[model samples]
Target: MSDSAPTEHVLLTPGPTPLHPRAVAALLRPMLGHMDPEVFAINDEIQADLRTMYGTAPDTFTALLSGTGSLGMEAGFANLVESGDEVLVCVNGSFGARMAEMAERYGARVRVVTAPHGQAVRVEDVAAQLSGVQMVAVVHGETSTGVLNPVPEIAQLLRGTDTLLTVDAVTTAGMQPFDMQGWGVDYAYTGAQKCLSAPPGVAPVAISERALARFAARRTPTPLWYCDFEGLRDYWSRRAYHHTVPVNLHFAFHAALRAALDEGMTVRQRRVREMGAAIQTALAPLGFSPYVQREAERLPTVLALRLPEGFDDAGIRAALRRREISVTGGLGPTAGLIWRLGLMGEAARPAPYRALMTALEDLLGERGVAARFDEALAGVPV
Candidate 1:
C-alpha cells in the first residue's frame, strides 16, 4: 500500500458521511481507560442520550459497540435468534437481504419476504409471511433504494405476537422520526456515521426488555462470542472488561450525540426533510427522477435517482471525481441504472446540494446531455 495516495475531503457517499468539526476534535481528544471513572460516566451519558434519540423511554437497553452497523445486526441476531428458530426477513434492498443472511449464519431458518427494488414492503405482506416466525427483521430505511419502510405500522402488526421485531435504522436514526417504544420495536441498530455525524467505528444498538428476556432464555449458546448481547450488557453495565473498548471512538460518539441533542430531534428532522425536498425539486428539471414514487415513503437522508438514457454511470462518476465530488453508483440490481446520493448529517444542507447540482450539470453538458443548471437550481430554497 502506498502512503502517497491522494485524498479528498468530499464524502458524498451514502454512509460515512461528512463529520462535524467538533466530532473530529473529539476523536483527537486525550484517550482514557475504558474503566476510567470519567470514561464510564461518558458511556452512561451516551447510553441515556441514545435512548432519547431512539425515542424509547425505559423499555430499551442501549449499547455502543466498537464496529460498524453490521455488527449491531450480528449482535441482534446472535442474542435473540437460536438454532432452528424461524426468522422472517423483509427484503427490499441490499441491507434487508443482509438481515436474512446474518440470521441464517446463526443457524436460524430464514424466510425472506421480498419487494421490488424501488417499492416499499407492505405490512400485510410481512404479516402474511410471519407464520411460525420467531423474529421479524426489516430495514427501516432501504439505503439502496431510498425507500422508508412503514416501521410503526409493521411494529403494530407484529404486536402481541411471539415474534420479536428488529429494525435497522442505520440511515434514518437521527435524520428521521423513530419511536422504538411507541412502535414496539424489540431491537433497533444505527451507525454513528450516517445521521449522527460521528466517525465510523461505533454502532449504537437499542434492545427492548422483551428481546433481552429472549436472549436470557436462549436454548443454545450464541454463535458469535463478540456479539453476545448478554455478555456485552454485562461488560457495558457492570464494567467487567469484556474487551478493550475503543476509547477515542466513544469520545467521537459522545460528541456526536451531544450535537444531535443540542440541535434537537425536531430541528434535525426538519432539516433533513427540507434538504431532501430541495434536492428532489432541483433534480427534477435536470431530467432526474427519484426512484421512490411517494415522497412520504422516501428517506430524507438518502436519495436514489435514475440515470438519464444513454449516459454512462461510471463515466459520469469519474467526471465528478475530477471535480472533487464523490457520489456513488447503485448497488445490486440498481447498479449502472441509478445513483445513490446521501444528504446525511452535516451534508444535509443547501450548500452541498448546490455544489452537487453544479457538478452534475457540468458533467452532463460534457456528455452531450442538455441540462439547464440555473433552472434546476432555481427550484431550491435559499
Candidate 2:
C-alpha cells in the first residue's frame, strides 16, 4: 500500500506550511479588541513564548510586528540603521540579497559579502568586512537554497565591538536552535507561518538590550514609526497603542506557540532534522540530491533538492498541485533548477514524509526512471 500526500493542507510549501489543528481552531474563536484585557493577556503569552524560542533573556525586547517576515526584515534595519551608518550584508541567496537592499533603503551605507547561490556564506569572508561597519547582517537560514549560515561563529566575531549583529531568522526560528542571547546577536526576526505553524501576517522579533540601547541613541529619527522598536515594545510590552494588532492572528500565533512548546523545541528540531536526513538519504539515488551539497549546512525544515537536468520543473509542480500537494521552486538564480520541499510544523511528522515519498515514487514511475522508488527509500521513507 502507498501513502498519499495530505489533501487537507495542500501538503506543504516553504512558508505558510499547514497550521497546527489548535491554531485552526483558535481562528474560529471570537475576536477581541486589540487593547482588551484578554488580548493583553494573549500578548503576554506570545511574548514570553517567543523569547524562549529565540533563546533570549527575559528582559530582552520582543514583539509581533503586523506584517509578514519581510516586514520583520525591514523593521530590523529601519530601527537600527540611520543615514551614513555602514552596514555589511552577507548574500548567499535571495533573502540575504533582500537584507542588503533593505539596508540601503534604510539609508545605511551598505556593503555586501557574497557567496554563490547554492553555497553557505563563510564566516571568514564576513570577518574581513567586519571592521567599521555599524552592523553585520546575515540570514540564519537561506530557504532559497536550503543552507544554514554560521551565525554563532559570525556573532562571536562581534563580541566586544560597538558593531551589532542582526539576523534574519525567518525560516529557522522554531525548527533550529536560536541562541540570540548566548550567540550575542543584537536583532533577529521570524514569521508566524513557518515553523510556528501560525497563519501569515504576524512576524515575531527579538531585540537585545544592546540593540535597544543603540536604537534609543540613534542620531536621527526612525524612518518608520509603525514598526519602530520603541513603539512596538510600547504596544506589546506596555500595552500602549501602536497599530491595530491582528487580534485573530495573535489567537492563532498563541495557539501555535503552545503546540510547539507542547512538543518541546528540542524534539521539534530533532524531528525536522531527522526528516531532512531521511529524505536526502532516500532520494539521492533517485536524482533528488540536496541543493546544499554539504550535508552539515543544509536546512532541516526546507529541503531544497536539485531536479535532474531534464526534469521539467513546471510540469512536476503542476502535477504535484493536481494531487493537492504543494512544493516551492527556487527563486532568482536557482529558478527552474530546484524544488524546496518543506516538512514543517504539523507536516514534519512521518505521515507527511511518507505522503511525500509516495508521490515522488509515483512521479518517478511516470517519468520512467523507476517502476518503484520504494526500494530506494525502503523502510526509511516514512
Candidate 3:
C-alpha cells in the first residue's frame, strides 16, 4: 500500500470507531461459504458471545444482518409493526426520530414524544404515551448529543403492559452494562463498529420470544422484503440462504467479540468512564463546559462540549483535521454550537485523549484565544 495513497485516517467520531489491529487481520482472513460448517461454528460463537455481552440467558434470539445499525432498526420495526398498529417513539436525538420515521413508513400509527436534544426522555412521559400503543422505542445511548437514556426505568414501566420495549444500543453495547432480560427489553440492536472496535457493515440484533411471537402473528406482510424478520430468521437459524451474509464482516465481528471478552465488560466500562472523566476535567479550566448538565446522565463514550464564545465550530473542526485529528460537529439543534468528542473502543485510550486535548489547546492559543494548556493537562488525573 502506498503511503500517499490517501492514507485512511483514524476515526474519532462515535460510530465506525477506530478498529483494533487484530480485527483488521480478521477482516483480511479468507472468506468461506456462509453455509460451511466452519462458518456456522463461527456464527455460533458470535451469538454466544453476544448473549454474554447483553447479559441475557435463554430469552434472547440473536441475528447478524449484512448492513449497518439502521438495518437492525428496520428489522425490529418491520417485524412488530403492521398497518394500524399503534407505536410510541421517544425522540431525544436523531436516532429516536429515525425510529419514528421507520414505524410510520411501515404503516403504523406513530406517536412521537420528544424532549430537548441534550435531555433524557422521562419515563413518566413514555408511560403516558404507552397507554394505547403496541410498541415503544427509544435510543439507549443517543450518539447525537451524548445523553444516555433511562432505559432500565423505561423498561420497568412497560413490563406488564402490552407495549413492547425496543432499544437502540448502538453506542452503548460493549461500553456499558446492559441487562436485556433482567430489564425486560423485548428487542434491541447494535452496530459492530462503535464500541466493538470493528469495521462497519454488520449489525447484531437481539429479540425476546415475546417479540418473536409478535412477528409470527403479524396481520400484514412487512413492507420491506429484505428486512422481514420471519424470513431472515429462517435463513439465519437453518443455515439456509435468505440473502448472502457479509462473510468478511462476520470475521471482523468474531475477532472484535474476542477482544471484548479478553478485556472483560467491567474493565471496558471502567476504561470508558475514566476516559470521560479525564476529558471533562481537562476541558473544564479551558472554558469548554459540557453540553449535558449531569455528568452521570451523559454517555461515557461520547462527549458534547460547548465551543468558545467567538470560535466557529466548523473552523475549529477544520483546524483539528489539519493536525490529523478528527472530531465531529454537532447534529440538528446542536449544530454549530457544540463539538462532539468520541472516545470509544481502541480510540478511548489515554494517548488519543491527551493528544486531542493538547491539539485543541494549541489551536485555541494560536488563534489568539486565551487558554491554560499546562493547567488543563495537569487537571487530568493519572
Against the reference, the lDDT scores of all candidates come to 0.84, 0.85, 0.83
Per-residue CA lDDT of model 2 for 246-344, tens digit only, reads 999999999999889888888888778776666666677667787888877888878899988798889888887787778788888889999898877
Residue 218 of candidate 2: its Cα lDDT?
A: 90
- Please, what are the lDDT tens digits per residue for candidate 1 over residues 1-382? 7889675456788988888777999989897888899898999999899999998866467989889999988889888988899999999999999999999998899998888988899888987888888899999999998889989988998888878999999998987888998889999999999998899988999989888889889888887888788778877788887888899999989998899888888888877776666666666656678888887787777888887678688987888788888888889889998888887888876666567777766766533222333344455442
Alpha-carbon shift of residue 262 in model 1 (angstroms): 0.8
Cα lDDT, model 2, residue 155: 91
lDDT digits (tens) for residues 1-382 of candidate 3: 5666674564678767889887999989898988888888999888888988887766477878889999989988888888888999989999999999999998889998888888899888887777788898999999999899999998998877778999999988888989999998888899999889998899998888888888888777777888788767776677777888888889899999889988898888877777766677667756778898877678887888887688777887898888777889889888888878887788887766556767776877642122333333344442
Quote the lDDT for 108 in model 3: 86
Which residue pairs clash in candidate 1? none
Q: Per-residue error at 368 for model 3, in Å?
A: 16
Q: Estimate each model's TM-score.
A: 0.93, 0.93, 0.93
Task: Tell me how far the alpha carbon of residue 346 in candidate 1 is from the true structure, in angstroms, after superposition.
Answer: 1.1
Clashing pairs in 3: none
The numbered model that scores best in lDDT is 2
